[model samples]
Target: MRHLIRAEWTKMRTVPGWPIALLLAVLATIGLGVFTAAGNHSSCGGATTVCPPPTTGPDGAAVDDHFYFVHRSLDGDGSITVRLTSMSGQRRLPDAVPGVRRVDTGLVPWAKAGVMIKDGTRPGASYAAVMATGTHGVRLQYDFTHDVAGSASRIGPGSPRWLRLVRTGRRITGYESPDGHRWISVGSTSLHGLPARVQIGLFAASPGALHVARADLGGSIETIRYSSTTARFDHVALEGAAAGGWRRTDVGATIDPDGSVHHPGAARASAGRYTVTGVGDIAPRVDGMAVEKTLSGLLVALLIMIVVAAGFVAAEYRTGLIRTTLATDPRPGRVLAAKAVVIAGATFAAGLAATAATLPIGTHVLRDNGNTVLPVSLLTDLRVVVGTGMLLALIAVLVLALAALLRRSSGAIAAGVALVLVPRILATTSVFPDDVARWLLRLTPAAGFAIQQSIPTYPQVTAHLVPQSGYYPLSPWAGLAVTAGWAVLALVLAVVALRRRDA
Candidate 1:
């Protein structure tokens, strides 16, 4: 077994074309990634100043953390309760009425207004709250990504919703009530390292309304319109360790050149009643330049990989080298396994080297060009880099296995390309409708590309979660498993055919 593997490795290295093809694959991946990064520039008023980087949460994942707050510091264990009497919002219209910018009274489905206990007024700090949403009813949300549904009822002047948050050390619990009297626990979460002194407040936040516009060509484009939410809170009560009077802060607001907040949210108080209006969200960021976008050249590298893998096995058959090689080994399955190991290892190493270099360099170029790349956790970043390498190796193995079965390089290469590349192109290019595109990615070997997705879709945030937008229907490992399943099946069939055929 050892000698057979050694002989296979020798043959692969001695072939100048194979070694050259692998090198070209690596160069293509890195070159294309860096080029894509260089091409992308900030469109935020031609300056990077207005295009601030996405806020990162406590977990270091990109998050949206903008809202209006009327808060007082709590030095110890405490609770805050408020009755939300009314919630209203307005959305900007795409077309303006003559000389006037038209606006409509409406709220995006996730607009929230409620009571919150937060570590600080700073964006991305750990926090928890019970809120009344536009259409999602009452919800308990915390730590930027966690959300638990409560009541399915809406709030209005006649029918108000009561929200409460209690903080005891690091644990925070939320409760909702139809009336201020009877309360029901919504949910609870630990802020782990919460500070002894924290901000307890009433907040209002609204995410942008998403509208999908059909393009004249064929595909659809998603556009987010500006929207704001206002909530009237009365019967506000606080318990335990209050430090001072209420403070107003437009948390996460953008500062203008004169140091004033631009498009700032507002909070007003009168007779112990508070009206808060906010213009952003508190959820994971789903829209931006994903870090993996720099690896746009990966598809081109896949082509090179398929060519090399096909020739690895098909060349042996073409030159009648397999007869001499197999006669020495005798057992065909062992020979096939040795070839698979050699090809997969070589491709994996080359891919790892290319992707590891490409990701960081491309990310730097994107930031240098004033583009805001969405921040991902270190684990997620490592997964993308390592997963891309694994994807390449799996595809190479699949192609090599097919080449063994077909004994013709062109046939195997064509089949491999159709299975892997074509599906991805159709899915991402919007050549097919969204449903068909998603299915193409799910059922085909192209599913492996999901491993490159850096942005995770959040149900709490409304955005375009589609293939064209770089969000895959399947999770990373699951997608890779689909591709692996195909590769393993092909390898098994090839081994069986070799045993029965004349070879």
Candidate 2:
């Protein structure tokens, strides 16, 4: 096995064009990524002002993080209960057309304020809470992106609402009550690995913009700037050995002045009662416009790799080198495997270096251009880098297998490139609708591109999540598996073709 790999490596290096092709793959991937990144300017007016705030979805990509919080650490099992006296907000109405009824102001449905238990003060942490919303009534929200509605009772100046969050071990239960004493369970969730110490607090946040369709005109949704929510909390009480004196810290947007509409007032305590007000989100923003948007270059890189991999094996057959090489080693399968190992190894190395370089350079360019770059965990970034390399390597191997079966560079390269690129093009372009595009991606090797998707489609967020909108229908790993299955199947057929037929 070792000798076979060494021989194949020697042959690969001796070929002048193969090495140049690998180098081109690296340059094209990085160059295209940088160009795409540099071209993306921030939509927010300027860098000095926080135009697009940070908020995130379930996948932890930053979305909109404008919110206010007043909290304290709870080191053990505990519960926090508070009476929501009133919740109010103003929402912008769509532009009025002549002769049509002009709607001016209304409450944004998801504007929220509630009692929460969070892993920490950081955005996108694992946590759960029960809250009263502006127009959506009551909800049980967990893990920054998941929302479940509770009682249908309306929240207003005349109607008072009570929210309670109880922590028992790793499980957290949320309850709502018209009066503080009697509780109705809203929802329950387990925050796995929640530490003994966590931030349990009061929070308020409203989406910066809401999209509302004009009543008179269907299929036209207008984006409206949402007004902030002011929630008055009284009779705030905590029960647990670890819950005592509380602390308050602002997360993303700063606390506003006392008289301001967006003021996130400091919590005041007197006579076993606490009052706190906040205006922004405690969740991270989704910045889908960054790394995920710059993937056009990856397709170019994949094309380069397909040509190189197909030619690698087809050249041996073209020059009648396979017979002489196999004459020395009677086992044909070993030779095929050795060739695959060499191609996969070199492609993985080049892809990894190129992808790693592209991400940081692209990110710097985006920030310099005044674009908001959403933050992801180090783990997510590492997965993207490694996943890209694996994707390229798998595509190369798939091309090599096709070349083995066809024994013609042109035929194999064309088929291989079409298999991967054509489906993706059709899915992304308007030629196919979203559902058809999604099905093509699911059934074809192009689904591998899902590995590059960073931003998740959140149920709470109203944005285009189609392929053209920079979102993939499949999860990252699942998409990779689809492509891997194709590669494995091709390799098996190639091995069978080699064993049965003359090389």
Candidate 3:
């Protein structure tokens, strides 16, 4: 087992052009991350990189980059002043009316840096403060240091009053340690009324800092020891439920509106505050935008990667190296597997590189357009990007299979290009309706690019418009599946041809 793993790992790591592949993967991952993290603003606004104070867009809607801002209390909440340094290079200002674009400092106490989520949202509201008794608005007296301005900022060394949330109804005695377990809490917050967005990190005062290194957010995979239904493991990979009917293995609690779940061992939540990371993808709190972009890019990037796959197998066939491969491996199936594995890995890694490289550029565009709403799970988004690259490797497999079956480099290249590229061109023209185009797009790279359509708010290359045309070209997963199906069908044909043809 050890030897097999080591051999595979070595081969996976040490391919001739592997370094370039890994570099590409990292670049693509980061690039996509920064782009989506900053909110793909170029798909958004004008010359402004980040939304300026009291800023409004051409759509007559004012855009704010920052989300949370509570006002200081009028009486008991005391006086609190919070200053935000512009890390986005430019900033967004808030306003009372959505269409009225004037940025007035007198209206917003925190200048152009605040957004009000209080009173179910009052006009021209900004700033957060913890009010003392007898106060109506949110406010905290005094200010902290703004010394730590970058991603790294340190708070405290004063009164370490922290807010913690905990579950006791039937969680796996779950506990999380932050900052490498330094600031540990076992039983923190008690579940109560109303769902809340509980977050712990850095807040700024005149003296406060934002020292953030490893923002570790983990969901417990508990053993389901009890349940209300016949627990099944065939649907998923689970180890925690070995001794019991453990309800939540990935997320916290899942319940139907009837106050029940697929099982009875399900845990309950406090208030309406859903445990997003603990729960499945119920909301945008855990966005897969980066994943969407990565997958879409992978579909496009795979078109480029087919060239590499062809170079390896098709060009080699042209140069007669494939005969040498047969001389060494003999078995067509084994050789095919080896080549496919190498190609898939290389393409996946290269996709990652593309994602990372695009980060700085994407970030610039996002901030310029004023869309800086980053999700909590940035790393997960990176994984999606990496997956897209892997999808390209699948594309390579199809290309390699065609190369082996035909044993003609030029013919295989032409077929591969036709399979991947032509549909995108067709989709962009007035050739088909949106849905019709989507189904037909499966014939080209556009199908795969559909993975990047996380939101319905993506551009349409198709000329004719429909009801949901502006939303998503195709669902991301569905698009990937379509592309995968094409690759698989091609591979199956290649296998059949290889088995029958004389080497």
Candidate 4:
């Protein structure tokens, strides 16, 4: 092993431009960190207000926008009648917050006549809405609807409008289009209680400028598909109408307006916190996994180290160099062992260097994003984190053994990619309930992330929650273990293959 380490190191050190690459990696990492530590980096697109925006800022500085498109689920017995006039949201600020004042960007030029949007509250609805004009609209508005000053706009070509309404956590998507396949995205959105039949359409005042086209509503995905492929509200969806295309029903209820009863107004009268059990998420979205990137890059450096070792091992095999190497060292196993050592030492050094280089850059990136990994970081918990990194390099050694066993670069890379890529792809869907997805995802090469998870089983809701999904989703640690297990299994397979196969 020591001989192998020496041989590998000698080969890597002699390689042209190798040192430069290592230097660049280290410099980039620390430079980014220093930059981030010096600058102000907050959440994207929003001004860097403190932790929370102040409630009583200068006038017009605060704007709370709630756009609503209301509807009622229709019964098979009758046309589904619905209204849309008002929408509002709780101020998202510090605990002791108060509203500054009210403002309105009332009814657009396109909405149908007689329907005016104003401050009104609907019983059971969470938000105060601005809906159709007049007495009927007032009758529907709940008390909270008053003083919810906000502007409204129709889905238009100019506005690039799209409506995404979420009522009781269920999302609805709708669009207008002359062609069924091509659809327009809606702009005004509403958050009503569950079992809502949200009525939305395009209308005009004075002389009708807009014309009706078509409308349809399912869950969210279908609506998105329609809009992505077409224009906005060109199909002519009206906000308040007796016989429109959209409606919501009880979970198990049939789409047809059978004898099922319609839900009362859109809000919950006395609100309670809602929780959905077994709907867990696997977070730490890929973008945030900086340490994971470090591990990967280090592993790459390690792989290059392995290739260096293998090159020495094959020196005799290449251009009669192995013959001369064997003649000089004489002991086949001992010579091979020495080569392995050189490779391991060099690779581990390179790996460590790569890791050290990334740390500063990763720190800066996180800081610039106004986010920091917490509870722990790689520096504080180097054992587990470094262990993961070393494990990756060891994987490289095992692969190098196979390369020595195979002696062909194309064969090695092909075999490696073939083994690793599919598994990683499958693992992304690891949270899926399908048995195959679970079995397949767990068997990926990059399984170390299981340890990095901040939370186990992050709260994730499913698009469709059916009973027969599969073996339950694994906890984050368990999921990571699944990946590690695959790695161990692969190493074992390589070991056994090496022992059995001829070089």
Candidate 5:
């Protein structure tokens, strides 16, 4: 086996075009990635203030941490209770006349209001809350990503809801009640290191309203309109070491040039009743430019890899070198295996170098250009870089297998490229319906591209999660498995054919 692999490696290096093709693949990957990242730029805040990076939650994930908070300091073990009497929201609509914006009473489904216990006033602080949502009824959420359903009934003036949060050391428990008398446990979780002093508050928040429409040309157009939510809370009580009076803060509120809050949330207090209005969400960030957008040239790199791999095997057959190879090994299966290993190894190495360089360089360029790249975990980034290398390697192996079966370069290369690229193009270009597009991504080799997805589709957040938007139908590893399956099947067929047919 070692001798066979060494012989195959010698053949690859001696062929000048093969080596050049692989080099070109690497260059294409880096060149296109850097070019795309540099080309895309944004004028964030008109150069006065560059866009801030997304708020990172306690778990190190990017999160939306904006809301209206009316909090007071609490030391030691404590609990806060509030009765949400009403929930209302408004959405900005298209102007009826020039310079005249119109607004309508409405609510995005995820609008929230109730009691909260947070580590501090800072955005992305560790916290927990029990809230009444616009349409999801009552919910208990903590650390931005975790959510638990409390009730399915809606909140209104006629149907007020009572929410409570109790803190004991690092542990926090949430409960909901219909009449503030009978309570049901909603959920409980422990903050890894809860501080002795924390902020207990009543809060309100709403995410942007989204409208998606089918375009005449193709695909879908999504518009996110400004929206805000307001909630009235009364019968507020805090059971613990209560400090001074309540303090109001619009966490993550935008500031205008005059140093005034833009689209600011408000907290009003009167006779122990509070009305809080807030804009923005408190959840995992599901919208933004993903880090993988830099790797836009991967398709071009894959094409080069496929061509090189197919030609490597087909050239041997064309020049009648296969007979000598098999004559030395006397085992056709081993010879084919050697060729597959050589091509897979070469492509994987080149791809790894290209992607490893592209990700960081492209990310830096994007950040420099005032674009906010969504933050991902170090593990996820490593997976993307390594997964891309494996993806390219498997594709090269699949192409080599096809070349072995067909004994021709052009046919095999064409089949391999079409099998991978066509499905992706069709799915992303909206030539087919979204359902059909999802199926294409699910079953085709193009599914391997899911390995590049740095942002995941979150069920708690709403957005346009389609192929065109870079969201795949399958998980990253699962999609790679689909590609691997195809490669294994092709390799098996190629080995059988090589063993049975005359070389």
Candidate 6:
């Protein structure tokens, strides 16, 4: 096995064009990535003062983190209960143009004000809350993105609702009540590693944009401005050892008499009652969209890889080198396996270098161009970089298998590129309907592109989650697996051909 692999490696390196192709792969990947990132600029001018600084979600996507919070740090297990007397907000509707249709004016359904327990005040920190929403009634939400609806109940001056959040160690339970006495459990979640000292608070927030579908236009549209929500809390009570000596601090936006964008109204407390008004989202915005844009160069890199890999094996058959090589090895399958290993290794090395170089340089370009880049954990970034390399290596192997079966560089390269790249191009363009594009990506080898997807489609967020919009129908790893399956099937057929037919 070792000798076979060494012989294959020697053959690959001796071909000068093979090395040049790998180098081109590296350059193409990094060059395209940097260009894309540099060209894309943030709408906010890269200033937190003008717009909320870009924040990350638990899943590592970038988001807008602007809201109003009144909180106190607690030292241990505790509970906070408050009665929400009213929830109301002014809805800003877009003006009607002479030709353009007028958008409706109404509160976003998820706009909320509630009692919350947080790991800390940082934008992406884990936390949970029980809130009264603008139109969705009550909800128990946790992390920076998960939400669960509770019983529907109207909240106003006459119809008051009670919310209680109990923290016992790492577990937090939410309960709702029509009157202050009879409690019904909304939901329970564990905030892993919730510190002894955590923030317990009252908060209010709404998204910067509301996604609405326009049937006449045949797609979705976003609201031009945000709507603010206000809620009055009374009978505020705390329990357990850490609940005493409370203090208040605003979490995201501040109160300004001048009525600036950064001002989310104010929180006022008097005689055990509190009134808080705020705008902006408490949840993280999906960062995967940015990642897709930054890494758009991967398509070009993969095309270069496909051509190089197909030519590598087809050249052997073209020059009748395969017969001589197999004459020495006799076992044809071993020769094919050795060729796969050699191509996969070279592809992986080149891809890893390209991706590693692309991310930081590309991210820097994005920031310099006034775009916000979402931050992910070091582990997640590592996975993305390494995963990209693995994806390229597998693609090379898949192409090699196709070449082995077809024995013609043109035939194999044409088929492989069509199978992988064509669908992606069509899906991203307006040439096809969004549904057809999504299905092509989902069912074809192009699904492998999901491996690069970093943003998630949140149920709570309103956006088109199709391939054209940078959202993959499949999860990252699942999409890779589908490509792998195709590669394995092709390799099996290639091995059978090698064993039964004359090389």
Clashes of 3: 75
Q: Candidate 1, residues 1-503: lDDT per residue as tens digits? A: 88988988998999998999899999999999999888888766255356667789888888889999999999889899889999999987776566677689987899999999998899999999999999999999999889999989798759998888998888899999988889999999998889999999899998888888765545568888889999999999999999999999899887899999877898888998999999899998876788888888888888999999999999989999999989998888999989988899889988898899999999998887878888888899899988988999999989999999999999999999999999999888757777788999899999999999988767888897888889899999999999999999999999999999945
Clashing pairs in 1: none
Candidate that would win on TM-score? 1
lDDT, residue 459, model 1: 81
The candidate, 2 or 5, that scores higher on lDDT is 5
What would the per-residue lDDT of candidate 4 be over residues 1-503, giving only the tens digit for each residue? 45545664666578654555545433443454444444535564124642332111111111122122223332111121122222211111222335544223222121221111221212123322222221121111222212221234332333322222212222333222223344343323333443333332221111111122222221111110000001112222233233543332121111236765322112111122111111001111111223333233432443344344445444435565655555665555555555545545454555555555555556545444554332233343464345444544444554555555566644554554445444443444323334444455445544443443332231211122111111224544565555455544544554455445422
Worst 10 residues of 6 by lDDT: 215-224
Candidate 4 Cα errors over 4 Å, as ranges: 1-8, 17-47, 51-316, 328-331, 371-384, 429-437, 448-503
Give the TM-score of each candidate: 0.94, 0.73, 0.45, 0.40, 0.93, 0.82
Candidate ranking (TM-score, best to worst): 1, 5, 6, 2, 3, 4
Q: List the candidate 2 regions with Cα displacement exceeding 4 Å.
A: 43-63, 67-113, 117-128, 132-139, 142-162, 167-173, 176-282, 292-296, 429-431
Between prediction 4 and prediction 5, which has the larger lDDT? 5
Q: Which ranking of candidates, highest lDDT first? A: 1, 5, 6, 2, 3, 4
The Cα error of candidate 3 at residue 39, in Å, is 16
- For the record, the alpha-carbon RMSD of candidate 4 to the native fold, in angstroms, is 18.9
Off by over 4 Å in 5: 45-51, 94-100
| TM-score, predicted candidate 5 vs. hidden true structure | 0.93
Q: Identify the runs in model 1 with alpha carbons over 4 angstroms from their true place.
A: 43-53, 96-100, 257-260, 270-272
Could you give candidate 6's per-residue lDDT for residues 1-503 as a string of tens digits?
Answer: 89999998998899898898889889988889988787777676555534445666556556555667888778788899999998777655665665554444445777888899987777777788999887788999887678888988868768999999999989999999999999999999988778899888788886644544443333333344557777899998878666445555456565466866464457788888888888777766654336546676777888888988998889989999888888989988888899999999999899899888888889877766666666666766777788888888888899999999999999989988888889888776656666777788778887887877655567666455667667777888888888888888989999999898864
